[model samples]
Target: MTLVIGLVVHRSHHRLFQEAARTLTGVRLEWVDYEAEDEIRARTAGLLDRQRLDGLLLGPVPYARCRDLLPPDLPVTVTRSAGLDLALAWCRALARGWPATPVSIDTFDQETVDEVAAALDLDRERIACLPFDPDQPVAEIVEFHRRFLDRFGGRYVISVRTGVVAAFAGAVPVLSGLAGLGTIRAELHELALRSQSKRASERRFAAGVFLIAKPERSANLDRARIGLMNMLLNTPEYADGWIEDRGRRGVIVFAHQALFEAVTHNWVSLPVLAQAQDTLGVRVVAGFGVGPSARTCVALAERAANRAEQDDSPGAYLIEESGVMIGPMGPAGHPLHFTYRAHGAGIERLAERVGLSPATLSRLAAVERGLDGQAVSPSDLAGSLGITDPSGRRLIRKLSESGLVIPEGSAQVNRKGRPSRLYRLGIGAALAAGATAPAGPGDAAGGDGGRDGDGPVDGGRRDG
Candidate 1:
């Protein structure tokens, strides 16, 4: 298949890019000419709806002017003046017997201007510089150069813009901008590769649902839907290809996998979901599913949505293709956001004694809830805390020192290495009396607190 790349250029540079396109193979270059910023934006928008263009290459001026109007997912290349191009421009000035000092520049950014000044060893204070801004009116730009010429007494103008060149037509000598055809070719090649990659990634199907968990009696569902629309539309990545079902109980969005990755940024956290919930002033449980087929993706998404709705506050969940259930993420504004602190000071004091952060304690406390007052091993705690086993062991040691976890009897398993000992959360009279924890394994003042089992707290390491 031929890779089609669109080029937007001013009329003067039409022959330059057209000639460069002829030297390339395995690609088709589509050229469009524009005289003004608004024209470029309007023409590009129209082209996007009608053309099958893969990527776009625009001059720096056109890019700055028309970028917001283009699709965010589309790969775009903005050509800038660079090394050889700058050298050529400078060589031309020298060939014309132009003086090194008092050269007025109005095209490139500050970095490029500084580089040219340093390369020519010109006096920094004497070189008149103005950074290019495509949005600035032509008259204002003309006046800026007019004042610059008066201030520096410059006899020549150096720029890449045709407008700037026309503005100085009869007043002074104008030099072409630094960037050449070679730079444009290289940038277009890179943009084509990026466009191909994005196109491949978009082939996968993905879907997600946001279920409102019984809205408050006083809340306005209309206002909530408006907030939802605003949030989704403002985030450009998820805005496209979305089919939203704004039902009374939920909002289901079916979109491309690219949007899912953009919304989550491929992270395990729930910041976006929490932000949505807060912005809408409602409890929203979301579930996302990604798969090869839209039907399969929607089914998995429905399962995840059900899991999220079962939770008290808003949650975001994901079901991967490998059948792994990912989350029931916490809503940031929920009243019981921290489950460890939900019961009040006792757990907070216990967390402080064990030298654990409140967030970690909250997660660990959640694991304890599933066990119904049972002990948790380092591996189990690590799994719950999403940390490594070594880190979990370190935490267990700290808790042991704080008299919060007491070692029980050790038991052998399948004649393996040393027997893994049992441990439990010691919150009875011994803890109340402020007794110190055992110094090491087997130094605790008790027998086995409970028998070993395959539960979250028992199968792995010893408590102490």
Candidate 2:
């Protein structure tokens, strides 16, 4: 087995190992900082959803209310002083023989259990002392030995250590753990630079979130990157207007910043990614960049997310037109007076795809004019549906957002001191048109959309 050494981060050990490194042969130096609960969770979740990290190190992080969020199989080592607080967690893993638990204590206070027990009225058998020679150089000192102390079944038997240590790593020998920390130092630095206790609000940029899949993996990691390219370069369903040069690493401001905060706070297991972190797809990492324009943030967030893979490292997947998931998604807000008036709907799959609400849908007949069968811009169509011109622009965006309509081509026309946009339907519209062919005489409903999933069109009667 290759040995990986990670520095301990906790309040138990106050000294730096004054010696050369040992674990770097196969391990990496992980940086862990205490961040707000949500940030930490999102970071870890984002990682775990992709790459597989062999170990995790939560440096000096207090084992507060965040024990359960971590996956049980992965080996974990923490550097916090209050072990007793995590008693329930210990009791849990101990009951099932699950691994991934540990602690680092000081030699001067080997008898910490007695003190900890008295404070909580618990027995000593629940806690055990994992030894590390304090005087030995840093590499020799262990951080999370308490994880192994699952002997003697007793309530509240946990460990406690002293002060912050340099590095604390967690691991899952058979697989990679997407380890992450609540980045505190960097946050403080950014806050300090801005001269505000709270962050100054700014408008976030329009970003895209999508899913992609590849046929193979390459050292160049091109399969996934190219998959991302396929998502951004050609599709005309969503964000077609701004596919510029593959959407470089521009700023991704989010309205879902609040949602990211919510997810990070709620879930554990930080992210461990292994692909597309530095390319045309880089702009989508803003899972928590929330502020004034919150809805936009939500929209962008709905588009991007990280998913974990097994066997090897993790990969990122974008669920756009060319990504893992295809077809149209329900656009937020109402269409005409109908909340479900978003396009990609109509007979056959129409009612079943969208809950029936004829009152709201009848308004679509008023969705402005393309002059008989004349083509009109998506923006104008959405406007006829009551959305502001710019917000209506979302409907005009392409494949990345919805697989319902693909633009045949785009052209610009100048009219009355303003530019008029022109567009022709692509694959999605064509599909719907083909599918909408009138049903035969035996057809029960005038349409043949999604009643197929509900039941057969044949009328079933009582056997009286």
Candidate 3:
């Protein structure tokens, strides 16, 4: 039987190690709160001197510091991030079974070299650290990742930011540094211990909240719609809040169905529910999708969240798979299906045309593809009308005056903030509804107008 010793540098980590120590038949977990560098190496040596001890496990920090004192004669294992020769050496020691517990410390610096060095300690020159700068941006990070993959022939990165993820594709699988089904629980032990000693650490948590409801009356619809809008905008106005709310720019509050309900029939307000870490607060960005199916509706809302965060129009933020303001309005009560059929073809057309919001393109594509006028909410018409986020109402007013789209019903004015406008289809809607032939010669057709213009996709303009 082997005797294992776990050198816990922090007392708070005891419970975790005690449980893990049970996995090894003869392993014994112990602690030494090393406040100094010498203490770290001394404690490690003391454990190594124990003849019955078969292996050693070192804490991340202390193991990293006193790596030289760790014995080649003992089986050693260290706790740390990947990419270190010192770690591999300690692991090798443990794999072979040792005279004492193996101690190792892991550090971010020269991890690749450290791991390679331990594995090929016999040939120092051949063990080298690969090129990398921790502060590189997304593009540079991607390049670094590619180089790493090429160097190792088969390797994966532990963590990556959102930007580079789309570029890496299948070249590698993304893995978080944290692992284990009960890892959160285990990490909590370390965190609590560190906290007791007054250590500073960033918060690690996220949360989501969803508000659901149907409008019963125009007043209820007004309150509920404004309520939702106020909720989304609330976050940016405050230092901290439940939601990292998006969709504040092109918010959809009172709309056709909502107006009808408020003015005519009554509807129920759905409850709001959320889930997240106790430490982390929740943030929300409301999304609205118009469709016959619940699936499409939810999809629209999800898109709303995306657009809001990116500072985009809610219409462009979601998915629509039905009739368009620019195209033929689907039969009432069946907008979802019409949108679905027209959405893809519209997107392709949009790539060629440019300037139109996804909503505007959607509406225009619908019209060009079909015969009758499709549904054109103020928001949909605004998208089809190519109104920038700040101009949702102005575009609606312009289209209404131009005779492109029409409001489904009356809308309340918000004098305290931006004035709320109603939807009305007119000539603008017709132009959107009609499959516009490529504009003759040079009418500024698909010209450099708004974001994602002839301008760069990643740089200025598009970010908004």
Maximum-TM-score candidate = 1
Better of 1 and 2 by lDDT: 1
Full-model lDDT for every candidate: 0.63, 0.31, 0.36
Models ranked on lDDT: 1, 3, 2
Those runs of model 2 whose alpha carbons end farther than 4 Å from true positions after fitting are 1-84, 89-115, 120-392, 395-464
Tens digits of lDDT, candidate 3, 1-464: 11224454544344555565333322234456554444666776665543223345554556655667765534555554444323444344545553112111112446454554456453443222323233344566566566655664533443313334446568654333212214323443443344322211112111122332222322433443334433322211110112222232223331223221211111111112111101112222333444555455556555544543443211122234452211111112211112212222434344344444533333343332321232334543334323454465554554445444565443323224442343323433334454444443332212222223221111111113
Give per-residue CA lDDT, model 2, range 28-125, as digits (tens).
Answer: 23333323433444555544443233344453332233445556533455433333434343445556664323322333234543564456565454
Checking candidate 1 for backbone clashes, the offending pairs are none
Which residue runs of candidate 3 sit more than 4 Å off their true CA positions? 35-38, 50-52, 82-464
Reference-based TM-score, model 3: 0.20
How would you encode candidate 1's per-residue C-alpha lDDT over 284-352 as one tens digit per residue?
A: 778888888888888888889889888887777889788988886554432222232233344445656
Each prediction's TM-score versus the true structure:
0.48, 0.19, 0.20
Ranked candidates, highest TM-score first: 1, 3, 2
